[model samples]
Target chain A: MDYCRSGFKPKRSLEIILFTSEEPTRFGISCLGSRLLAGSEALAEALKATVDGQNISFLEAARSAGYARDEDDLSRVFLKNDSYSAFVELHIEQAPILEEEGISIGVVTNIAAPASIKVDFEGNGGHAGGVLMPDRNDAGLAAAELMLAIEKHATESGSLDTVGTVGILELYPGAINSIPSKAHLEIDVRDIEESFRNAVINKIHKAAKSIAKKRKVTLSEFKIINQDPPAHSNGSVIKAVVDASDELNLTYKYMISRAYHDSLFMARIAPMGMIFIPCYKGYSHKPEEYASPQDLENGVKVLALTLAKLSLR
Target chain B: MDYCRSGFKPKRSLEIILFTSEEPTRFGISCLGSRLLAGSEALAEALKATVDGQNISFLEAARSAGYARDEDDLSRVFLKNDSYSAFVELHIEQAPILEEEGISIGVVTNIAAPASIKVDFEGNGGHAGGVLMPDRNDAGLAAAELMLAIEKHATESGSLDTVGTVGILELYPGAINSIPSKAHLEIDVRDIEESFRNAVINKIHKAAKSIAKKRKVTLSEFKIINQDPPAHSNGSVIKAVVDASDELNLTYKYMISRAYHDSLFMARIAPMGMIFIPCYKGYSHKPEEYASPQDLENGVKVLALTLAKLSLR
Candidate 1:
């Protein structure tokens, strides 16, 4: 719609694509649409995924949504190697860096990748009062110790880019008077440098083992969900964005995107770049997440100019 | 049935009473029957209590169970001051102390009281990858810190009788890639001494405040569900239990009952005593929890002798 409103005719054909499941909200796999187009091996794993409480497989849901063509021949969804000249995405900067710096435009140089893991601890559950302190093997405390350790390792990784979160925690037979016999946690760690992120993850694993041993609990499971390498922006696409921002006289800064986007997978098939606009307090994935009209307009203008330059090239 | 089979009869009249809601499995109130009989002020609160998911009031359930005669005149259910001569309960030892020591009988001298509290933490939620380590105000981590602190304070309270457990933990918007915006925890602290248990609770409150302030999260709520004082066994009843065990030549030890029972509430209205036989591995409130037939028989014999003596007195 913005391109149509601009009324700028391009010499080369341009395509706009909106990807789905980039947030991993539905099937627990982000970049579902783009990953499939890029021919990710995760498709097999995702096909077996089931919706919680609904008892429906991802394959069934996809078929119901009219996505799957041939159940056995999924290659039909993959894009050809030479399908596009360049790919660029305009999105809200999901961090406070751009907004705090008063930058109108953010030229993303790198897209940080994430590594997620689910850890489950098993301990003896007894009456909370009946079990003496020395006799207790508390799974909840073990998970708590590991959670603090994850934060410590990420913060002490000697890089500000490193971040970790323990977002999901569950205890079995959750009652006020019963000791927890099982604790499960889902952890997310990210960095632009894969090595650094993995290093932090290694520390987490070691801490989990040590905590379990010390607490006399069992680290029953430590499963890694995904670990993808960071994607670097193409020089040509970066130059086009820089040139567009310079021509428009908009204040812009080169930044790394900590939030994942479809462009991360798109980089596998084509040269990919991203443009970011400042949102309110840099809040994303929340009800209060918002971007000003002026910021959106500036982003659209820069994106339009960059697309035109890429087409001419 | 055991007494009838033994062909043993008591010269004084005897009554067998079974209490309901001793586990707090319903309506979050333990010893509901005994508490009501002992004329606890908690009856007012219990009357307003509602079941989870079903949305039925405790009063309604009691009426449906044919227990409540008049909703407004609940005092009719209360036992008179001089209702019974003595109260004695026989149960499985919910801890490993007796089983580990190979003791056949446990003469409970005191029933440890529990103090339960529910805490809720509020923090900023965002994309796990987008939120930097330094910028995060994670409610889950805050709760974790407080949980560990509670354990530390209770363990260091200079009393082996002190114990604490964080049984229920819940995070809002619990997703693999989303930072937890809110965390709710239910903590149970117990001790044979009321002063010591209350001390640990006070330390927990202080630690909770400090953790919330340090993490820049809000300690939205700290609600105490119950705080009951420890109940001591009457000297006359304790002597009766000891004399009975001695007459049977059974190996016995005087111990504190860390788990609450109807005997605790009964102590408020009548002289009360409890006898415990070992359960497998001290496992209570679990499917694997078990007591041998021999242990059950021994417990019954001791209880029978103790009741016979109390009746004669």
Candidate 2:
């Protein structure tokens, strides 16, 4: 922003695009910014070659949902001569690997996309006092069992870079004295290895089915809230970040990003790279999450040099 | 009420009392109406002899809380010579025994009072994604084990009329992505026999301690919210109801009411009896709870006969 204010012009006709895709599309993708890149001809073709209607493409859904294309939006028109050659994003490393190793800069190798699932369990409701064990079918108890089972399966799977989380566990008509008749759980499973995630999720499915049968409760089909594969950074773009990191005298690592960012979808259209700064104790998504001033300055210098190098080429 | 309106009065000067003790006192004992009866000379002495300062008598609390007395209220003054002889109450049976058996009436022999316990478990919190087993203390998992253990202990207690219930089981900061740091459970245990209740509660205490130790979580002291000994109906009053049922030709059973009512505390003062008519499927505390017209009429006729006999005595 300071360079743009100072009118430091690049060698080429650069627009210095600042995109904000804040809207959430129906497929549960993070933002509408992904939809912008999905609208580009190259990404549309790439996605077509991979996930087949896993759900409708985000941009198609957005368009159908009345997000009309504006002539001013660059993503709606990828001019043959004006295609972007490279992309880069800088973020705080959400995991402890870089921080524990005391690295100043991390060149993210890939982003872990999540497959979110929601399970609804239904059981009989009655006065908690009067319902005896033999006669009572408690949905909350079933949900508790499932939550524990998820933790167990995830732990025992021993798959590297694989993580499962239950973001929401709620009981309906949540009065203390009434037996819960319904329970809803939101589970997010993410891994760099697709096969490993599928294996853990399969185990969870089997466990839930057996528990539901034993407890005589109705377990609803696990709904796929969001499903996206891991996205890898372009090798050449990663080289650019590495080169810049070395130029700036900062140690760098090629680490798998455990957190997802807009760049994951942006990679659909353009070759993309990611730079990460270490946060204290590998904590992110918390108020206490912090990065050292020196590490942040190192990231900014690397980002500037990398952007300039990409633009000049 | 019809007999008094028609001026077909009995030989004695009847007060035809309708008293209300609607305020909840500190001890959480139900039916402050019993407090009015406790204020009566007989019940106060009886309670003082048994339950040691069941929180300094409800009447004392009510008086201090500014419940001004109405001199005209008969309950405010039970003159020495005007000591009551008997008390009887009619209510819907809040259990399935009579409704399931097609019985017309239940001659309740006693009421069950509960000793409710609350336990809080505190554990370390961190990111579910990054926290691995053997290094993580999840309070939510500990809570799940405790809930299941409670069910197990209660099922195995094997004491007749003993019941254990967990009305509230909660995880603190219950977000899906973050590991839960705390758990709270509210347990209610009841039995007609005080020893049986203590036995079940002791088992729960042991189970919670073992679980907290195993999970390495800090457990809060168990709190007793409501503790009252079961109240037994008077033999003479029970005999009166039995005789009335025999005269009215309604089949009756000597039942122990599982749901407490004002009559539970009232039993401490005058010899008291209760009569119950079956509601649909024995469902009380619900909008769909209903008693057949024929069953209600039968209950009313028997209640009138029993009151006449008690008043005559």
What RMSD does each model have against the real structure? Answer: 2.0, 7.9
Model 2 alpha-carbon miss at residue A101, Å: 3.7
Minimal lDDT window, size 10, model 1 chain B: B44-53
Q: Which stretches of candidate 1 lie over 4 Å from their true place?
A: A1-7, A45-52, B5-7, B49-51
Residue by residue across B1-313, what tens digits does model 1's lDDT show?
Answer: 6666888778778889988879877677778889888987667555664564578777778778786647655667788778988999999999998899999999999999878999999988888888799999999999999999999999999899999999999998898777888999999999999999999999999999999999999999999888988899999999999999999999999999998889988999998999999999999888989999999989999998999999888
Q: What are the candidates' individual DockQ scores?
A: 0.79, 0.25
Q: Write model 2 residue lDDT over A1-313, tens digit each, in one string.
A: 6667776666654444454433222333344355445464444444333322465654454456666444223444443322668778888786667788988899989877657788988876555544555776778778878878887887777775677766466775464455677788877677777777788888888888888999889997677666677889999889889999898788999988766777776777778789999878666445567889988888888888788777777
Candidate 1 docks with a DockQ of: 0.79
Q: Give i-RMS (Å) per prediction.
A: 1.0, 2.9
lDDT per residue (tens digit) for residues B1-313 in model 2: 7666766545444444454533223443345456455455444444333322454544454456665443223255433322657777888886667888988989988777667788898876555544444555677777778778777776787865776766566776665555667777777677777787788888888888998899899887678766777889989889889999998888999988766666766666667789999877655444556888998899998888787777776
Native-referenced Cα lDDT, model 1:
0.89
lDDT of each residue in A1-313, candidate 1, tens digit only: 6556778677789988988877776667778889889887668555664563477777678778886745845667789878988999999998888888999999999999778899999999898989998889999999999999999999999889999999899998788778899999999999999999999999999999999999999999999888888999999999999999999999999999998889898998999999999988767777879999999999999998999999987
Question: What's the lDDT for candidate 2?
Answer: 0.70
Q: What residue pairs are clashing in model 1?
A: none
